[model samples]
Target: MANQGPKSQTILVVGGGIAGVTAAIEAAETGYDVILLERGPALGGRVAQLNRYFPKLCHPTCGLEINFQRIRKLKNLRVVTMASVAGVKGEKGDYTVSVSVSPRYVNANCTACGACAEATDMEVDSPFNYGLSKTKAAYLPHEHAFPMRYVVAPSAIGTPEADKIKAACKYDAVDLEDKGEDFEVNCGAVIWATGWEPYDPEKLESYNYNLSADIVSNVQMERLANHDGPTGGKIVRPSNGEPVKKVAMIQCAGSRDLNHLPYCSRICCLGSLKHAVYVREQYEDAQVDIYYIDLRAHDKLEAFYQRVAADPQVNFVKSKPASIRIDEEGRPVLCGENTITRELYEAPYDLVVLATGMKPAASEGYVPDIAMEQDEYGFLVPSVEGDGGIIPAGVASGPLDVSMSVQSATAAALKAIQAVGPKS
Candidate 1:
């Protein structure tokens, strides 16, 4: 019998977040052809939106920049932004993947020049900031956007503003008629690293997320502390632009509840703790209160929990907030039972940060019809048989922090390489 093996050794990585980026780089550096796809206009995913991570509290962009540099230097790797997986077919070591690309309207001719932005008077809510701010219709994705190209919003298409944007570009980078294209690639293995999204706080009706702009989600808190964010790094009330004096961080806002995720997201506790640090660093007199069903700072993170607990200004309350109400003065008031004291309490704060948990991006329903299996929570599950056909990495496999996501990506890369490598 003739040998039937992988026709191509190329590996395809879907989702250009830290996980996808790491897998692509690791595989390409190991001398394998890799293609990285991102659904957005750029490569960086949720990690790019963060102010800083826990423990070290180090800036995310610094690490992303290094990875970006590695990507730029690797000739065996190709990055396709504004692209998504449409479908997948075939078996391990031999697969055909279909991809759909969205038009950026701006092409490789772009020089990161601000001329295109200066031309458009129309604006759109910036998704990078999670709609906390607006950007020009012809705008770059973010400050650290990989490829560093501008994008023309679809709303600007066929409008006079689009013409103005096209005319303003000196490099002819703007292509007003550029409709995106769909294509297929034959590869040996696939790595799924689509990452995650923040749980919608609006669904937590009792939290009254829409009742007051002063109430924000944990992801918004990250932007509130980011220098590139809406308030320019000021931890202020979104309603009136005033500094927050009294702050409340509610843990497990949408997780570990039968009505919601019903699983511990594992990052909420530490995230809220880091948020406490951001508040204290900005305002010394600020008093921050954390309310949780229970603190789950498991394993190595206990030290961080202990350090934050030591702060005299940061108080830990043993309770789960039942609802949030607005006062006559339009302030957000927390109403709930204090489990420790076994007493009902209502407390008003200048701002409330809901520690909303992570929801797998695959849950949004864009995943291709493939052999992968998703848990009830919507996280992709790797094959237990270790066929190495379709691998799940990073947050797509489960809820994981940045460091762990990288580790997951590395493992996925190795599995993909092994699956595609020449067999004896």
Candidate 2:
């Protein structure tokens, strides 16, 4: 593709999620100049937040490492993290875009050293750690994270540690004076793959997610299951840190409900099932139960479901738990009617995981002036006209698995390339 000569075409990809990353890689491979913007500190997006992906059941780092390598090798692709698209001008074949990038203190020169961390006494709840763990003022996002650099949380740095960190950095990469900058770029096409954020469980007061310690979201479950997780990969009751003997997965926590997200987040069901298996593997004595309206596994996913179900430790209950409450001893109690039995009953467990759904990241006031269409749910809808000016992929368009997200990203890249048109 390099033999086609340098085509002065540019495509701007918004969001650093799996879809955005895939689109950038594919477009750059096809010889189009690609620019990727991410609102987070790094480019892995929500995919990076996940523990093990389904289908292949591979750790996210396994696949993301390969993409990170590709990004390192692709000289034409430029990624701007901790950045946001401020505005847009022009249209179609040519557009002028302005972006605002926040200061991360440390930069590419960062060697992921613990020096800054050692010098700082400030501690904050790590959102990247799913709120289960804490990190120092200066810390890497995670072990084996791309860019392999420490990011200084300016907000978390207190006055004393802030000054200490400034003095501790040996490479002079720490730039507390580095304010955010805005710049413009010219692009022929744009891709919207901002991806989704987990639905806030506080909306469902019935689950008492914020009030109860044992009630956690699927994302939190991933952190609990990861070897480097809060509990060192031990599935335990959050209330007492006791090894959990019984676990329950509540599917459609914020999804498939008319009151919240009316659409079925396609991945939650399978994701919960996969976590169920993880729980069983960790605790042989653990009895795992999944409460759902339906299995909802599509295509080849049913095969994995069958394999997991046959494991004998998992039980599928076809009823949504109406309420989750803590018992006198701090155990989780699920109250709901079993559709098969047509009887109201309560099942007690040591842990309860809400298989929450995904919602558009743009809901939090992150959209730029690209003039694209979104569904009623705010998911970006790709143009059917094949004009190639705008591209949409991944959960930002709708809920989809990682495999499907990657495939959609490839399609979006092709569309972006075609939008550049053939050189005369």
Candidate 3:
């Protein structure tokens, strides 16, 4: 697949998460042809769902803007969203890839207008909104979403509503007949940056998350806290429209347990603490309690932890919540033994948030012929020599904070460039 006498080689970066995006950008800037494949409809990965990143409290859009601009200007980089790597062939220097792309009804002509959304009758629970809100069949994934285009869910739109949407769009960006296509590309190396998913709380029956309205996960809390959220940034009890007065944050809900995920997720403790601070900020009078077996705050995170603890409105309890049940009025009652006090107590709260652990993304199963290793926890195993043709980065490799994820991604890109050597 060498182009000529002396030129850069091609690299494929799978999974358009932060790590994948960084790898593609770095490789492309080094004069290599880079193909970025994302299973989702857009880039930015899990980080996109987050409202503000920790340490600096930077907005998600702020961090993503640089990469978006770089990708737009780079001629050697091609981003294919709604696509997955189906299979692979050949060796490291020259590999053949089969990419499967999904259909997005809208194209580059989309103007981010709300006309199609206003005309559509279908309403589906928005995954981007974390199920806290509803979106029409023709919807933009999120505010400040990349490509700044709206996509239509064919399954969500009926034939009648679909016709109306086509009529509503003044720009003919809606491609009604666009079907998914598959193609092959030749690349010298591959980078596996597939990210993680939140541990399903339904597996933890003791919390009764699926059955209770007030009990929610950290991700759901994000949606609740977002100004563009379903409730317009109101922290209210799901059972009623009343404001949440008391909030309880549970740490390590699905992590650090031998029966579940054996290793510490590394980010849960700090994430819970961050959410606790968020709750207090949302309701100045709200009493916030954080229950945890151990508060594992690494590096500079301890400073943030100390600041939150110094807040008079916050309570830090060292204990793992044994059970959670709802009261008559839909308040959450948390039962656990306070390890320090050695006393069992049941406290009622207007709302409860479980800091769930991360798992491999659904796209992990679609990885091509790469024989990459994964830990028992389903996280992708990193290469020992740091020279694996497939480089793992970000949350896909393990639990890491936003800054750490970005650092790891840059390192992965360097390794990919090393693998490709001096091009052809």
Candidate 4:
């Protein structure tokens, strides 16, 4: 019989977000061969969609660029995009993992020269922008994509536009007949870093999210504030191209309720605070009202809350809004009782931003049916006795900010290395 023990020192890092990328880098730098897989056409998951981080509010690209540079210099690390784990067989330190690779239709010959995008007039909702904007059928994932490769949308396949896109590429990089294939990776350890997704605002029935275009989710608000977003960094009424003077930011839109996410998302409060800053910086006369059940800012982040609270134009209401109703004039009105004041209040706003929470990717059926366990919230949980080589990192383990996710990834890397290292 073959020994079911540390036969290979290779580590497989799943998901290409900041957490997975960090784990791959840390493990590879420690002399372990690492295979990093991303389910999208390019790397940079949810972090790539954000406008900026909280508190310091620095651009996310700054850190991602440094990681990208490190990846280019590392010879032991290999990155495979448009791939996901299908299954796993065998025990810890001697596992064979089945993998599925989706067709990007654009091959390695891609120079990202923007020729294909220009050749096709077909447009599709851009997933990078959370569908807030439209992109050409043949387009790059984002400006800072690590591989810097373009993707041909499945919607464009089987159409005459596909031929145009292929013919326009000078290097003949577009592969119209390219079909995805499945393979297997032999590794001693696995790191699951699949991140979180925004809680759907449409689930909040009383919010009237579907009835009005002015009611936007927290993630959508990020895109709206982004320079490459649909509105060109201008916060406006999505119903019409009018500037927003009065904005209502609702905290815990789909979180901390019996019907929705029962636990605090940890980042919604800070995100909403950052959104307030985005509005206050753009429009001089903008009045921002922040409605919340309670603020969850703690530790070093308390100072950022204080800074935004100091703005006289920003108002904080200690209330959980009951519902949003549109008036005959098409204005959104908020109705709720103030827990502190014990009085009912009704207010109107040009735009309502719902601060949605994070839902683990595992909850959405993205995780494979492996030996790994999950908590009640569907976040991956490590075995109590440390019996397996599969480890969870970043938001895959729990809800965390960018800084916390990096810390989790670093710890996971150490654990993975120990799993495949020489047994003491």
Leading candidate by lDDT: 1
Candidate 1 lDDT, 153-224, residue by residue in tens:
999999999999999999999999899999988888899999999999999999999999999999999999
Return the TM-score for each candidate structure. 0.97, 0.95, 0.94, 0.97
* RMSD each, Å: 2.5, 2.6, 2.3, 2.3
lDDT against the true structure, per candidate, is 0.91, 0.83, 0.81, 0.90
Question: Clashing pairs in model 2?
Answer: none
Q: List ranges where model 3 is wrong by over 4 Å.
A: 1-8, 362-364, 369-371, 382-387
lDDT score for candidate 2 against the true structure? 0.83
What's the ranking of the predictions by TM-score, best on top? 1, 4, 2, 3
Candidate with the larger lDDT of 1 and 2: 1
Off by over 4 Å in 2: 1-8, 368-371, 383-387
Poorest 10 consecutive residues by lDDT, candidate 3: 1-10
Distance from true position, residue 251, model 4, in Å? 0.8
**Model 1: CA > 4 A from native:** 1-6, 384-386
Writing each residue's lDDT as its tens digit, candidate 3 over 1-424 gives 3341222267888888788888899888988888899888888888888766675556777778889999999998888888988887765666778888888888888999889999988887897877777899889988877768888886854578788888899999888877889998777678878888888888778999976778988888877877877777777887676898889999989888776667788888888777877778788799999998889888878888898889998898999999998777667799989999999999999888999988767334765435466666676765354336767778887887777888888888887788778855
- Per-residue CA lDDT of model 2 for 1-424, tens digit only, reads 1222233368889988889999999888876778989887777877887779886678888888889899999988888888888776666677777898988888677877778989988888887877898888888888877667788887854577788987898888777777778887778778888888899888988888876789999989988888888888888888889988889999999999989999999999999988998898888888999999999889889988998889788999999999987788877799999999998989889899999999888666655435566778988875455455777777788888899999989998887888777633
